[model samples]
Target: SFLSIAIGQETPYKAVVVTDGHQALETVTHVLVDLLLLDYTLPTMNGIELYDQLHAMPGLEATPAIIFTASLVKHQDVIEQRKIIGLGKPIELDELLSTIERLIA
Candidate 1:
C-alpha cells in the first residue's frame, strides 16, 4: 500500500499492490495493468518466477516488468535473457520513476 501510494502521488499510473504471485496474476487478469513492478521476496513464488507466469498468459507476453531484489546478481542471467530490468532493492524513488516513465513512454 505504501508503494502504491508513493507511485500514485509521483506519476499518472495507478499502482495495484498484491501480496504474492497468485494474487498478482489474478489482479492483472481482471484489471488493466500497464506495467509490473514486483518485489523479489514475494510469499509463494519469487518475482522472476512470477514474471514467467504472467508472461505466459496470452497477449501479456510483451508487457513491461521490473523486478526488485537485494541479491540481483543471483538472477542476473535470467533477467538479462528475458530483457527485464533487475533493479536492486532500496531503489531510489527518482530512479524508479524515471525507469517507469521510460518503459511506459
Candidate 2:
C-alpha cells in the first residue's frame, strides 16, 4: 500500500494496512495503536462509524486519528465537531506527516 510504505519509510512509527473495516477492527483489537489513519469511505462501514467503534475500545478512547475523505464537504460538519483531524483524499504527505508527528508526540 502506498500509505503504508510512505509511513514506514518516512517515520519511525509502525504502519499496518487493512483492506476493510472488518480487518481494521480485527487487527486493532489485538495490536496497540498509537494513531489511526482512516479512510472515510471504507467498505461495510463509514469512517465515523468505525471511529466510534474504535473509540469505544478501552485505552483507545483518546487515541489520535486522521480521517481522509473525498467528500470532505459532505462530512465537514461531523469532522469539525469531532476531535479527529480531517484530511482530504489524495493527501499531501508533508501535511500528513506533520499532523502525525504532532499528534503522536
- After superposition, which runs of candidate 1 have C-alpha atoms over 4 Å from their true positions? none
- Please report, in order, the local distance difference test score of every candidate based on alpha carbons: 0.89, 0.90
Q: Model 2 over residues 44-89: C-alpha lDDT tens digits?
A: 8989989889999888889998999988888988988878899988
Per-model TM-score on C-alpha atoms: 0.95, 0.95
For TM-score, the strongest prediction is 2
Q: Quote the RMSD, in angstroms, for model 1.
A: 0.9
Instruction: Name the lDDT of candidate 1.
Output: 0.89
Residue pair clashes in candidate 1 = none
Candidate 2 whole-model C-alpha lDDT, 0 to 1: 0.90
How do the residues 1-105 of candidate 1 rate in per-residue lDDT, one tens digit apiece?
777887999999889888999999888878987788989889999988999999999878999999999989998998999899889978878889999999997
